[model samples]
Target: MISWLMLAQAIALGAIGAVVAIAGIMRRPFGDWVLGAAALTFLTLVVQVVASIIAPIAGAGPTGDLLEYWTYLITAVVIPPAAVLWALIDKKGEWSTLVVGIGILACAVMVYRMHQIWFVQVA
Candidate 1:
């Protein structure tokens, strides 16, 4: 994984998580802003998927266990959409928002972990 891309993902997801959290704290329901943000974050993960495929070909392959890295990456890619669908289906207002917030924050952490596995930990 590219270092800058990893950092960008972390920061963007963290910011989105914070925003969603604040909306939940304010007792807001699942709204367009939240949905839009989640979609945007998911789009970034799609980019990450493409980058992961290309990076190895470009000589930036992960130094850690490929399985672990791919697992984290796959999970990160799945979280946003799943959380959004859960929120929409549950329609529990602030609770739904909070759940999505938690999922986004979790994705941010996973992105950081993926960075570690890619660049910090060596197999």
Candidate 2:
């Protein structure tokens, strides 16, 4: 869970979400853009997970509690796949928009979780 990388991903996801939402509102198709963004996000998550595992073994700073970090990591990794699946399953524009909305919300929550991991009083 690199703080900078997490923040960057979250922001990128949020921006993509906004673009999808706007496209939806305008009665335009945004699936291609959504798919591309999701792919990028998934790739970033994969890299982040690998780096997180290697960092601690190489004597980096405290990687935080394993359970807490894994929960966030899993959720972050699952989201893009879930969103893409949902989009694929539904051809309706409304449902596609809903999926984007969910992705945006997930990213927003992840942003808060990232902040907590970085600055909160973890007991």
Candidate 3:
């Protein structure tokens, strides 16, 4: 993981969390706007995953186990989409937004762990 990319990941997670929180506060459903924000936010994870894979090919891989790092990365990627799917199925209106917000917060923490795991071997 490059230093700048890690910083971007942090900022992305923060923004994602903030967006979700705002949705909940505004009593916004997982409608078009919310889903759009989620897609953009999830793009950050996609970028991270791409960099993770390419860095190894370019001999800039993380110091940690590749399997472990990718595992965390994959899991981080799943969170938002899964929550979105749930929101679509759930009929509880704004309550579904609460679930989405909480899920995004959880992803933020998970992303932090993924960042830490990148240097596990070094530590």
Top of the candidates by lDDT: 1
For model 3, the superposed segments whose C-alpha errors exceed 4 Å read none
The lDDT, on a scale of 0 to 1, for candidate 1 is: 0.89
Could you list the CA RMSD of all candidates, in the order they appear?
1.0, 2.5, 2.1
TM-score, cand. 1 vs. native: 0.95
Q: Rank the candidates by lDDT, best first.
A: 1, 3, 2
Q: Write the per-residue lDDT of candidate 2 for residues 4-78, one digit (tens) a residue.
A: 776776787677667666766666654677678667767877877787688667765343466676678778888
TM-score rank, highest first? 1, 3, 2
The pairs that clash in candidate 2 are none
lDDT, each prediction: 0.89, 0.68, 0.74
After superposition, which runs of candidate 2 have C-alpha atoms over 4 Å from their true positions?
A: 61-63, 118-120
lDDT of 3 at 58: 92
Expressed as tens digits, the lDDT of each residue in 3-118 for candidate 3 is 67777777776777777777788887666766765676578788888887787789876776767778878887898898788888883676677667766777767677777777
**Which of candidates 1 and 3 reaches a greater lDDT?**
1
lDDT of 1 by residue, 21-121 (tens): 78887778988888888888899889889999999999989889989999999999999999999999988655888878888889899999999998888
Quality of model 3 by C-alpha lDDT: 0.74
